[model samples]
Target: MSSIDSQTTYLKYREYSDLLKVILYSSQSVLGAVPLIYHLKHNNQNIIFIQTGTMGGNVIHYLISNGPPSKKFIELKRLTGDYTFVDKIGTDGMSLYIPILELEKSNLDFP
Candidate 1:
């Protein structure tokens, strides 16, 4: 498994779980969807803005922590024409709007 401490731009999975609890409680809803945009300070250095939403009962987390684009993902993005995955987050990172579960299952990485 990858080391959570090595990640600089995104929160650990457990942290996300905690944040999801807070959002669910504060929003006071358990049926529909709640979208959230959070500005997080990472390691007291970089400021990263993460976008997430709750759908049905699942928390969908966008990942912007893959660092830079790998040649394989770039080619896949080009072939698929899914430029939406290249969204800019904060000042430097690019975002990929994949569901948290799918992200965990796939080995693909993006910028």
Candidate 2:
């Protein structure tokens, strides 16, 4: 896993956290009855935000059964073919906070 400059990232994101919170909360309200913001935590030491999969299962259930199907979700469902190993993809539910410096080193083109 790539190490992140937590301080830099925190500083960059801190100014927008309130705006993000408002957008997220509003979206959650629109979603209605879905588990969206499942326990948000921030580490004072690292200044990194962490959100655990407390109600992730509920969210998945809501998305699969009740929520409006998105194009990506439909594609993912088709690719996984029964939701068996869907969780095994990528970091397997683990979130990675990569620094901008590290992202710049990659071949991916982003602004």
TM-scores of the models, in the order given? 0.22, 0.17
Using TM-score as the measure, the top candidate is: 1
lDDT: worst 10-residue window of model 2: 57-66
Reference-based lDDT, each prediction: 0.31, 0.22
In model 1, the clashing pairs are: none
Q: Quote the RMSD, in angstroms, for model 1.
A: 14.4
lDDT (10s digit) by residue, model 2, range 1-111: 123222112112342233234323433464432122111112212122212123222111100112211221111122222222121234433221111110112221111
Clashing pairs in 2: none
**3-62: candidate 1 lDDT, tens digit per residue:** 422332333333333434433443345553434433333333222133343332232333
